[model samples]
Target: MSRVLLLGGTGDALRIARSLRAEHVYSLAGLGRTPVDLACGVRVGGFGGAQGLVRYLADEAIALLVDATHPYAARISANARAASSDARVPYWALRRPAWEPQADDDWRFVDAWPHVVAALAPFRRPLFTLGREPLAHLDAIPAHQHWTVRCLDAHPGNERARIIDARGPFTLDGERALFDAGGYDVVVSKNSGGAATEAKLQVARERRLPVVMLRRPALPAADREFGDVAGVIDALRAQPFPIVR
Candidate 1:
């Protein structure tokens, strides 16, 4: 069994770890957040940077490297790719495909989070399902409308950033209640591309509200790309172990 380092935090990462648990593979997760009951063995905190990551890989004698991070986590992915190359470890990513918009979805796709604010025209009050980092972007765009922002932590500071403290895998009833109670005419969500946060989109669809969708950055031109967990496991199995030269 190869000792693989799994760089992960997102749902896809969790999925991949669970899938490989029975393969007799010894897996360790590299995480920014303190893992709460992770599917595999874990290590928390940054690995310095690309150089630091490479050194850690070398010291641990990691046989494989998987960058199964969030799509928005470009810095870590970049570091993972660079470190894997430097350490001569086989590298792969478990990135999920972005959600496609249906005509009935009434989505306005935007490039950046800041730009998303500008993209919004006059509508009814919006329900913002934004990430913690980009919360300020909502205030950047002109305000002909109001917004309700959701966060796991107690969102303080910005009077403009209306805060709703809650967590993920949001229930359908909860989503519907939020929309109905907030009097939201539209939904603003990141193309996070996971089941956990998807209820917001479903709520928007039910209400026939316009959704401002933030798209993902393009993956680096790696040799492979897998839109699912199964594909990721296959990649892990196919890649040969690092040569101890």
Candidate 2:
């Protein structure tokens, strides 16, 4: 039987990992929590780069490489595509669709950090949901601005910023309360399309606050692409190898 290798970090990836058998492997970048309850074997940390990944695929006999990482994780996706090609293995990706602006949403799309900073100049209080990226800029916060940054891990923020460590699948009411308390004039977020953290967008729309959205990067094409976990699971089940959970 052919063995599968799943690269994952996002919630969608975890869902896919849960459906895998013990013969399959679930790989993580070691940034967040590692699950001990998974039936499939778990491997943490990186494979150096594309060349290293090619070696790993060959050494481990990975027949299928599934990239279920976050949508913004462009480098890893690119490496997976390259490594799969080099190793002559099938590559699959779960490319989550980005969130679209609704009728009442005031969204400003930015391609880089400098652009995001420029767009945020006028706002006194801004809520940031771009993960750990905002933590590095805490010292650079403008004199008149106070930032509320949310990410996966807790950190000690400077006087101009406050860090809240939390995960999502957040509720609408919870987001409404947070927005009300923060009194945020603007929201800084990545266009990571999923139900997990999408409540913030709806709250922003309801409160008439503008959102500065980080643009999605161009990822390398995979042999097959899926938009959701169910589709990926179905595809895996259809593979020649037995993938029963």
Candidate 3:
């Protein structure tokens, strides 16, 4: 009789929920738009903080916790670690394999967001995908620069970018078509760290466009690392969860 509070926003997390559906009662916690075909119960947004999560663990009797959030979401990872430890509960972080720069990939992996904004100085015909909220980061860029930016919202923000609002896990065909059609010379995106959003990178590779990519932030120490939901299930079966995800 185990109950778990799951921290997820990745495809793998949903898969883990499906894999363990027959055996465990799970409560999924995530951000952004809720998925339509998820297989478990859910909560959304920050868990108040470490103390809030601790309270939740005690009140809900969440015997275990699994984080499947985006790898770049460092804040949640830290919160999960501190909360789980303070509550004396077990936890795990499900992370996908990070994309590396291949010979074909002419990516210049920028270590920070500000650097990506600054790259605009030397480049043009740029395609951007820093997600929805970081649009302001582009404000510091020169106004004369023309950019092709994408988002999930229709009216993202007023900026120099020609905003393309669409959804993720985009097809390579569409991504490539957009880049080619737009005559993009450079790609600037975050290491958001998930396949759904990584499609853009693949598209960039196909076009051989130069990239100004952001690196992923750190996660708190976890008991184990899972590349997929199947790995998470296997770990839960084998031993206690990790310290962070």
Top candidate by TM-score:
2
In terms of lDDT, which candidate is strongest?
A: 2
Roughly what TM-score does model 1 have, to 2 decimal places?
0.80
Q: Candidate 1: lDDT of 82?
A: 85
The model with the greater TM-score, 2 or 3, is 2
Give the worst 10-residue stretch by lDDT in candidate 3.
22-31
lDDT against the true structure, each candidate: 0.70, 0.94, 0.71
lDDT measured at residue 173 in model 1 versus the true structure, 0 to 100: 90
Specify the poorest-scoring 10-residue window by lDDT in model 2: 236-245
Ranking by lDDT: 2, 3, 1
Task: Supply every candidate's count of residue pairs whose N, Cα or C atoms clash at under 3 angstroms.
Answer: 0, 0, 5
lDDT of 3 by residue, 1-245 (tens): 45677777656666666655433444444334675554455566666888988998888877887888778778878998998899888778887777788789987877776677676678767888876655665565476677777876665445566788876778777777887688888888876665677777887777777888788887787876777766677776664533122
Global CA lDDT computed for model 3: 0.71
Clashing pairs for predicted structure model 3, backbone only: 93-245, 222-243, 222-244, 223-242, 223-243
How well does each candidate superpose onto the true structure, as a TM-score?
Answer: 0.80, 0.99, 0.84
Candidate 1 vs 2: which has more TM-score: 2
| Runs in model 2 lying further than 4 Å from the true structure | none
Candidate 3 residue 244 Cα shift, in angstroms, is 21
